[model samples]
Target: MLRFKELVLTMQEFFYFALRAFATLPKAKRYWRDVLDQAFICGVESIPIVLVSSISIGALMSMEVGNLLEEFGAKTMLGRSTSNAVLRELGPLLMGLMLSARYGARNGAELGAMQISEQIDALRAFGTDPIAKLVMPRLLAALIMFVPLIALSDFAGLQTGALVAQYYHKLDPGIFWNSIYPRLLPMDFVVSFLKAPVFAIIITLVSSFNGFSARGGTAGVGRSTIKGIVASSGLVLVANFYVSKLVFDIMH
Candidate 1:
């Protein structure tokens, strides 16, 4: 019961925290430079990790699924199958998890450090809305950047999968792409692209909240950062499933 109450209180605080962050969206113009910096941190800096994960997953899926399909003489379906998996599901999902770790951890650790060092308090003492100056910019950056990251993830994954299909499975490039482009649907793109902002929200808010709640000095920063990454990554996975389900249900 005590734990439950603490959980409820934490939830309440987080609700207000996220509310304040979103409510400060208009203040973005005031913090445009910070927003640009955060964009670089979360977006541009995130590309390498995102591409590595997506390409690895795409190759693995193509090779493994291609082998399995070959058993049933269904190698021609490789493009369609791999395309669906990469574009609709794995692409966005991997990007979210990677960003949840990379971007989320950065937000948590940076803000947690600021919190512990009393920098945030100093801002508040000076009559500055810390959420508006700090968290809002990160939130805005993530929301704006995640979409393109997802697009890049999809593109890199599909291209890597195509290469794997050609060399590893001895499939023709033209055949593979032809099978993919024709079968591609708007829903596939919808499911892939829509996840960008959803993941952006979950990652940015969760991390920033934990950061603001940091305590216990340096150790607290570490704990808060870990908590942020774990929580955001888990939430990303959950949101991925629900978003896919919700979209497919509505569209199909």
Candidate 2:
């Protein structure tokens, strides 16, 4: 009950801050440079890691699913299974987890450090709304970047699966490619990218909340960073289930 209460209160605070951030968008144009900088950091700098992780996931899926299907003389289904898994599950989930660990912790620590060092207070002294200047850019960047990143991850996973099927599984690339499209529907693509925004929201809100709530000093920043990652990742996984369920229902 205590934890649930804390969760509710934190969510309330998040929504409040989010609304203020959104309302301040007219002034956001002045911070366009900051938003772009954040987008580069969160999206561009993240590509290599996302690509590598996605490729590994794809390769693993091909290997495991190929072996399972081969036992039943159904090796041709490898591409279908791997593609579906990547599109429906691994793509968004892995990207969210990666971003939560990388960006979430960094965002929290940066803000927490600012808070502890009185920089946030100084911003207020200058009549700047920290939510607008600080949180809004990060929020906007996360919202904008997650969809493309997930798409890239999905593409990487599918490519790797195809490669693994051709070289490792001794399956024909044409067979793999042909099976992928027939097994996929437009809704699968929609659902894949849809999960990303929710995960992005989780990361932004949880990280910023922890950052804003940081107390003590440098040590507090460290703690907030860890807490932010944990909370954001947990929420991403929980939200994934519900979002996936809703998508499933819609598709049906």
Best by TM-score: 1
Error of 2 at 192 (Å): 0.5
Residue 149 in model 2: shift from native, Å? 0.7
Quote each prediction's TM-score. Answer: 0.99, 0.95
Candidate 2: tens digits of C-alpha lDDT, residues 14-66: 78877886787677688999899999989999998899889999999999999
Worst 10 residues of 1 by lDDT: 175-184
RMSD of each: 0.6, 1.5
- How many residue pairs clash in each candidate at the backbone level? 0, 0
lDDT of 1 at 97: 94
**lDDT by residue for model 1 (127-216), tens:** 999999989999999999999999999999989999999999999999999999988899999999999999999999999999999999
Show the colliding residue pairs in model 1. none
lDDT of 2 at 186: 82
Note the Cα lDDT for every prediction shown: 0.95, 0.90
What are the clashing pairs of model 2?
A: none
* Local lDDT at 104 for model 1: 94
